[model samples]
Target: MNIVCIAWGSLLWKPGPLKLASGWHPGGPLLPLEFARDSDDSAELALVLCPGVPLVPTYWAYVDAPDLDTARAMLAAREKITPGHPESIGSIPAIDGAPVQQEIAAWLRGRRIDAAIWTALPPKFAGVGGRMPSAEEAVGLLSRLSGETRAAAEFYLRRTPPHIDTRYRRLVEARLGWRPLREAAVTCPA
Candidate 1:
């Protein structure tokens, strides 16, 4: 059976126990992603766009396991990848129109049991929650913080609600005077 595992948060940049057990390296030339945090209250997450599925607001980390046991084992291994703290694993039941969830369900329909599981650190312990700052605020923060921190903040900001355009316009106008919005030629690496 085909299983697709999805994970957000710290696991995106850092290699959890699962990735390590699978003989995969978390940071290297291939993965250009980086994360940084200030205290335990806020953090920034970013990744270089890779081939295959685009890692959007919700990125799906796909893995095909033979059975639920194997999937659980992988998750367990992933939990131990780190030295001190361990990541959490859970099944992502059907909810919302999440493409990753739907894809896993579709795989299960044909196969006997296309079981899948996800792994990540707890929100509180991971310090993942932060209000979506205005574009101006984000820019200011980015300038002050390191590149890794800025990238993480931008990644979260992009996924945030209330619309990027609206927030950016409001903040830009308020901070840098009123000006018409124009599409600039900016090269963003995935």
Candidate 2:
């Protein structure tokens, strides 16, 4: 199966166990995103899909899996998400025409891929009933983080793909000064 994996944040820099058949390609589908999820694993306000927000370009790479189910399982394992929580993993098969998948389905048209998957974790501020935090609230959470927790948070924000300039990212840059990191320049030996 020609399956692809989509990402916009940490996965771009630290893929951990995700098996990719190709390097990331720019110009993936545009999706609404924000740094709204307070990740338990990293204690960072991680970026997640946010429906009502501005759209940003995501990155895509071919997944090194034989089929969609295995692809999904592989991604779940890489993301550390336990079984039965399929909501955290979004999978769109070319044969399935669910209306909710129209945007991605359209993107799939004329492509060689047979399916695609992405992390679909929801917005979950710590004290806000799993709601997406406002820009101020997100920055406040980042500001309160100290020591290594703070460093991890900043690293996450800075390492996000440069094309993903979300509203919350702008706010974080303005308030916390955690701007995105650019690729380091390479030097030749003298």
- Say which candidate scores most in lDDT: 2
**RMSD in Å for all candidates:** 11.1, 3.9
- Give the per-residue Cα lDDT of candidate 1 at 92: 41
Colliding residue pairs in candidate 1: 17-77, 17-78, 17-81, 18-78, 44-152, 45-152, 48-190, 49-190
TM-score of 1: 0.35
Tell me the deviation in Å of residue 151 in model 1: 6.2
Model 2 / residue 56 / CA error / Å: 0.4
**lDDT of model 1, residue 95:** 23
Residue 48 alpha-carbon offset, candidate 2, angstroms: 0.7
Per residue, candidate 1 scores C-alpha lDDT tens digits across 1-190 of 5444544333444544453223222211111111222224345422212223222333344454666556656766754533332224444442233223343344345534345565433222123442333344444644565566655555453432211223343453465343332331121234
Model 2 local distance difference test score: 0.80
Query: What TM-score, over all chains together, does every model reach?
Result: 0.35, 0.90
lDDT digits (tens) for residues 1-190 of candidate 2: 8999888887776777888888788778888888899987787888888888888888888889989888888888888999867667788863233224455667888998889998888899875545988788888989999999899889878877666888888988898898777761111123
